[model samples]
Target chain A: MKVRVEVMLKDGVLDPQGEAVRHALGTMGFAGVESVRQGKLIEMDVAEGTTDAEVKAMCERLLANTVIESYRIEM
Target chain B: MKVRVEVMLKDGVLDPQGEAVRHALGTMGFAGVESVRQGKLIEMDVAEGTTDAEVKAMCERLLANTVIESYRIEM
Candidate 1:
């Protein structure tokens, strides 16, 4: 099965890379780009019949920084 | 309007970061993890009723590299 995971910095966390992208956009003449938040997408082809519990556990253990990042898993 | 853009490298492109993460996961004891592809998510709050053309323009101009990356936009 194919699982998709999105991990993003929690609200109030500083995102320097996102800020840099926004600045770059402004400089590149793409105006009115008010706010931008960046995240990561991890696509994995896990074994078939892998339980959601297992996927969630993988996310909690290895996929995300639970302290300052939150993750959503899609099967 | 709130828009989401996902940008990923084209197939056949080398992703060293993803490979590094995969190796790290292996060292951390997460077995049976097959292929992993990493991408970026850009979430932005744009002007109300921004046209799809405008969004596509943004993607082509600033959000992604057309030569090596593909992007999908969602509103």
Candidate 2:
């Protein structure tokens, strides 16, 4: 089965990399770009019937820094 | 309006970062992890009714490296 995990910074956190991208965009004349946030997309080919709980555990353990980020799974 | 762009490396390209993460997972005992690929998730706050063409241009010019990456946009 194919599973995907999208991990993103939680609200109220500062994202320096995202800010750098936004700055570069402004310099490139992509004006009026209000805000930008960058995140991660992890695609996995796991065993068939991998349970949601197992995937959640993976996120909790290694896939995300839950202290500063949040993640969601799709199958 | 909110928009998202997902960027990923072409299949034939090498991803050192992804390989590093996979190695880390293996050391942490995540067995049976067949394959993993990592990508980027970019979220944006743009003008309402931003055209698809505009977003596509953004991907081509900045969000993705067209030589080695492909991107998908969602609004």
Say which candidate scores most in TM-score.
2
Candidate 1 residue spans exceeding 4 A from truth: none
Interface RMSD of 2: 1.0
**Per-model C-alpha RMSD:** 1.5, 1.2
Tell me the spans in candidate 2 whose CA falls farther than 4 Å from its real position: none
lDDT of 1 by residue, B11-74 (tens): 9998887787778777877677777889999998777867898889889988899999999999
**Interface C-alpha RMSD per candidate, 1 decimal:** 1.3, 1.0
Per-residue CA lDDT of candidate 2, range A1-75, in tens?
Answer: 888999999999999888888888888877777899999999888878778988888899999999999999999
- In model 2 chain B, which range of ten residues has the least summed lDDT? B24-33
How well is each residue in A24-62 modelled by candidate 1, as lDDT tens digits? 878877677788899999888777877888888878988
